[model samples]
Target: MTPKLVAGIEPPYYTAVFTSVRPDAPEGYAETSVRMQEIVREVPGFLGYESARTPGGIGITVAYFRDLEALDKWRLDTEHQAAKRYGREHWYDSYSVHIGKVERSYGFERE
Candidate 1:
């Protein structure tokens, strides 16, 4: 299945592609994730995201933003920092973050 796209965003935006493997006992993971989602939405220039996970526990979330500065702000936010630390210490077995510029995009829908 395809990951759902964040709707209504124009092209030429930035995307942060986050992929991770979940740890066995992820205490507080869900709460932190929900809080981070809420926090990012309140950040200026924040767009939206698409997320999915495989049955084996690999997950991916692609978050879009208006520009590098907005992405940077989100990255540097204090709450985000805490979340990252928590992930490193408790939740993620391995992960990767890829930031890229989206110059153009197109899609189709079948009803």
Candidate 2:
């Protein structure tokens, strides 16, 4: 499968990088993840996101936002909070979230 790469975004945005180690038995994880992705799109300052998971159960999702305020809204979203709780209880064995500002970014694509 082709990896999805977020492109054309200007600099000075914020990114929330979520990395996780999933448990062998991931019951509701996939559904919740899809729902969260849908929900984030409705947020005011949402830019775009890129995500991928390895066969070994390690996953990373990077969500982009226009600025810090938009990132905060996502952090405090009610449904997202619930999803986080559920993931902690049932889905993720371990996880980490890194939020940072992208002062500059560049990329190249082949035709």
Candidate 3:
């Protein structure tokens, strides 16, 4: 399947980059991941997201938000909080999150 690339995003936005490694037995991870994706779209400041995973169990998800306040809202979402707990307890072997402000972005696509 072709991964969809986020487009039309301007600078001065915020991004939450989540990098993780899955445990050997990742029970419920896929479902929770899908749920989180759905929930994020409902967030007020949500812009878009890009995600990829390697066969070696390493995954990275970059979520875009309109601003810091919007990013904070997602950070404090109840369902998302629960998913984080579940990931810590059951799904992930390890993970890291980095928040950044995008000053500029550029890309190209061949038509």
What's every prediction's RMSD, in angstroms? 2.1, 1.4, 1.4
* Regions of model 2 farther than 4 Å from truth: none
Q: lDDT of each prediction vs. the true structure?
A: 0.89, 0.89, 0.89
Model 3 misplacement above 4 A: none
lDDT of 1 by residue, 1-111 (tens): 955667767878999999999954378888888999999999898999998888788999999999999999999999999899978988888999999999887787666
lDDT of 2 by residue, 51-77 (tens): 878989898989999999999998999
In model 1, pairs of residues that clash are: none
**Measured by TM-score, how close is model 1 to the native structure?**
0.91
The TM-score obtained by model 2 is 0.93
lDDT for 89 (candidate 2): 86
* Residues 1-111 of candidate 3: C-alpha lDDT, one tens digit per residue: 656688778888999999999954477777887899899899898999998789888999999999999899899999999999978887888999999999998888766
User: Residue 45's C-alpha lDDT in candidate 2?
Assistant: 92
Provide TM-scores for the models. Answer: 0.91, 0.93, 0.93
